[model samples]
Target: MKPEAHYNTGPNELYLDVRLLQNLSGTAKWGKVLAVLGFILSGFILVFGLFMQQMLQSPGRAERVADVGLSGFTIVVYAFVALVYFFPSLYLYNFASGMQQGVQERSRQKVGKAIGKLRVLFKFLVIMLLLFLVLFAISLVMLGTGLSDFSLQ
Candidate 1:
């Protein structure tokens, strides 16, 4: 049997450029800082939401129940907004950490994991943007119809 020819695969191995690594490292640090801030903001929003709910339930505030109810709705909205801000921050932080580790260790797997997290972050943002666009379009349509009705009266 003929011996198999040895093929050189070393040149095909992926290597991150020095400049790219430097850029990624800087970005990772910034992402970590932003993630920490996002967590703090989310915590505050949660606390404020709970406080609003508690105030609404207090006995002496019965006369302002309607206003309190509006506040309750506002709390829910804020909580959702906080969550929306939070999840992306978490993904961004993870990506940053992973990328930093990958660079330090020169591990392709770690870098791939970091890229995955970044992909998730981008996907979430895109979905949110699409949702907002749809809602804006619906609101515009509603406003136009209402205006038309008013003009006919």
Candidate 2:
């Protein structure tokens, strides 16, 4: 008979190492910086979208109904993109804040909440990555079909 290895699984054992805490603190600072940058970028995108819409609707330009509709669609797409960027940043910011507070106060609940926010951010990223991959595959298929249709005699 083989002897079983003993393992220490006490509830009082430290789950987080000191090194990890240091790293997390650094990450929180960077996250704050990134979140601010994302907000700035979203603002710029919003301004550009509005500017584009206005340019398309300017009285000096002879705008067709289709052109106006297209501009509106473009603005909508821009808004969606801006929202996508904004949301993840918001989550990241929250995580950073929670982690900072948790560490400062040595509160387990705050740390858990911070981890939860991080999970949400990761989930959103994974979904976006999958969506982009699917879109890329579809584009490749479309391009291949389009190229096939343009063969010279």
Candidate 3:
């Protein structure tokens, strides 16, 4: 059964005005655009990574890559990076979709789900940021101690 008292006075309940709905709609549109773009870019990256090994089969590419201390593993890393890029874009898309539906239907549950997806996306970004920071610190320490040569080589 649907509640007929959508406009009832509840202190903890949120009231979405016209302005808020417009804003949400706009945000959702933008988010959808960016997510689609991200998906396309990630697809390109994965395709490139997969075909890189075949490219290396060509004349001098493998030798050049070897000279740079890179090997077949580098292709795997590219694909991994692409996969990493994909999840956040997916989260953003889900958030956008949920928000749009919630606004259209005036469904608080859908909006809440959208917010949850956004929160998860942020948490994932923070974790990735921290991991990169730690890696940067380690790299700096290695360089300071003149151990970069040993590590890289």
lDDT of each: 0.81, 0.81, 0.86
Q: What are the per-residue Cα lDDT tens digits for candidate 2 across 85-125? A: 89888988999898887776666777888999999999999
Candidate 1, residue 81: Cα displacement in angstroms equals: 1.3
Model 1 stretches astray by more than 4 angstroms: 1-14, 51-68
lDDT of 1 by residue, 10-118 (tens): 4323366689878888988898898888889888888888887677767877568766466468678878988988898898889889888877776777878899999
Runs in model 2 deviating more than 4 A are 1-20, 59-69
Which consecutive 10 residues in model 1 have the weakest lDDT in total? 4-13
Q: Which model scores highest in lDDT? A: 3
Candidate achieving higher TM-score, 2 or 3: 3
Error of 3 at 118 (Å): 0.5
Taking all chains together, the TM-score of candidate 3 against the true structure is 0.80
lDDT per residue for candidate 3 within 1-153, as digits (tens), equals: 357576663543346889988999999999999999999999999888878766765677878877775567868888888988999899999999999988887777788889999999899889988998999999999787787567776
Q: Best-fitting candidate, measured by TM-score? A: 3
Residue pairs whose backbone atoms clash in candidate 3? none
Residue 8 Cα positional deviation in candidate 2, in Å, after optimal superposition: 13
Off by over 4 Å in 3: 1-6, 9-14, 63-69, 147-153
| Cand. 1 Cα-lDDT | 0.81
